[model samples]
Target: MVKKRIAKILSFRYTMMAAILILLAGGLVLLPKYQESEGIPAEQLLSNIISLERYVSTDQISDKLISQDPSFILIDVRSEERYNSYTLPNAINIPLKKLLDKEFESYLNQDQYDVVFFSDDNFYADQAWAICNRLEYKNLHVLKGGINKWFTTIINPKKPNENMSSKAFELYTTRKAASLFYGVVYPDQTKTKSVIKKAPRKIITVKKKKKMPVEGGC
Candidate 1:
């Protein structure tokens, strides 16, 4: 059942991409420039719009978080209120509406980390990706199926049947471990109590201190 639902969500990606490409094609000339470059050409943007490489899977994201990899950034494209209520671990909010703000330029334009955008589903995340892609940002991706997929695949993964392939069970085992890392309490982990899921606390932003330039450096 969960697989079916996720499949349905993924199937909509093409339709959404088409609509977004049309909108982008129509408005490309009107887009405002943040950097000196006027952004990528229409043909390149069209190619990017149709490619599947722009999506990063939930499994990949889970693995990165588990390993504490710092080469990637998760951008929650939802509302500020929604973001304050709940979001994936280490995700920072950059509401879809404010994605292009000058304040966030460093986050979106940098080559330091692979930037990922996500929302409840892929709708808004994909929009964020399209916008950034039009601006020719590198290392940008949309979380495939978004947070809903993350909850379904990582937080509370479904167990595979006995008849399922060994590969399936292996994946299930990995997901189980990932779930534990995220603090999910399974029924078996406690006595006489059902599983309890707790939402992580709201995000707290810590600004990094800038380094001072060397006095003698040219």
Candidate 2:
């Protein structure tokens, strides 16, 4: 069945990610004294790494934005230049290089909001997640397929074929509305320029919290 094939693909992806984890661990070892400690055990880190629960789909993110859900935070892991050019509505720019910076620790190392990290593709975002997960950060998720998938699914969704199921059309309708909500301008027969309303970027004030030990084991 289709589901079985999907499961196999995911299995393969995770297997590859496990290998990447070894390389990441080796790379971290060569970093400065600040990153000397391997925060979590290998087994636990691998368990967390291979889990599919770490991803939030584009549709889910779009729904949260449309509904104005305050429970999640979108962190764009691209550079400042790329972030300024284009990013998801309300996404905060936190470059991959500065992810472990003291100033941004509260945002990533907290249990409050569901922090979602994304980049142009999964590469940078997954690296960010791996680094954080090793440090035992909680409630961290990567945007599935990153900004590229978001643009394809939410910004410029293709119309379903006539023979497609009703669910497909319903999804298309939702995506169309979401695209407008995120300020995607579509061509009109009248040819008048449509005013695009941009959402202001959010600022998070980091509150000092007592540091606690991370406890986990496989």
Candidate 3:
């Protein structure tokens, strides 16, 4: 009888200890972990998103580049291969994958310079912009058309029609000059007729034979 009584007391003690451990674990989960600024407030985050004015035109960027504006910090969000092939002057490459890395957050989470992001198109750059904007980072902007648009406007500019306004002509001339400075090739005004050639067709031979027996003599 005494042995049985001691066994019951030991089992009850273990049960109580288990219950206490479970409660402690739950309490830890309920406690909030800390961070630097606690990020953007919910209400203000919504307001900033709805009121966002986050695009900068290629023409404006070009003007800034020509004037050597120190406030502009162009960010290339494409892969390293693309960035190495071609990128805008004074632009830094921080691939979309690494945008949130600690090494890059200093540049991304600040308002000192006008951060302009660009990719082959607007897609990747827009994504980077969204992340920074969500974090309530200030002075962040996307290159309206990205590098492709830059090529269209500042590189291979088209001449305005004869009836176009002088203002249009003036803009074209500026783009032409910018193209020269950037060492980009302009479309030749002299038209060249394109000759289309057809690829050679391949010949196939068909063979007929008696059906072969199935595997394992099926």
Q: Superposing all C-alpha atoms, what RMSD in Å does each candidate have to the true structure?
A: 26.8, 27.7, 22.4
| Candidate 1 C-alpha lDDT tens digits along 1-218 | 99999999999999999999999898976775644566787788889988999899999999999899999999999999999988999898999889889999999998889999999999999999988888878899999999899999999899999999999999998999899999897767765233243322212222221222343454
For candidate 1, which ten residues in a row score worst on lDDT?
202-211
In model 2, pairs of residues that clash are: none
- Per-residue lDDT tens digits of candidate 3, residues 55-156? 788889998998899997999999999999999998999999999899988888877888999998988998898778777788988888888899999988
Candidate 1: list runs displaced more than 4 Å.
1-37, 191-218
Off by over 4 Å in 2: 1-37, 188-218
Backbone atom clashes (below 3 Å) for every candidate: 0, 0, 0
TM-score of each: 0.69, 0.69, 0.66
In model 1, the Cα lDDT at residue 89 comes to 94
TM-score for predicted model 2 compared with the true structure: 0.69
Against the true structure, candidate 3 reaches a TM-score of 0.66
Stretch of 10 with least lDDT, candidate 3: 199-208
Clashing pairs in 3: none
Task: Give the Cα lDDT of each candidate.
Answer: 0.87, 0.88, 0.83
Candidate 3: RMSD to truth: 22.4
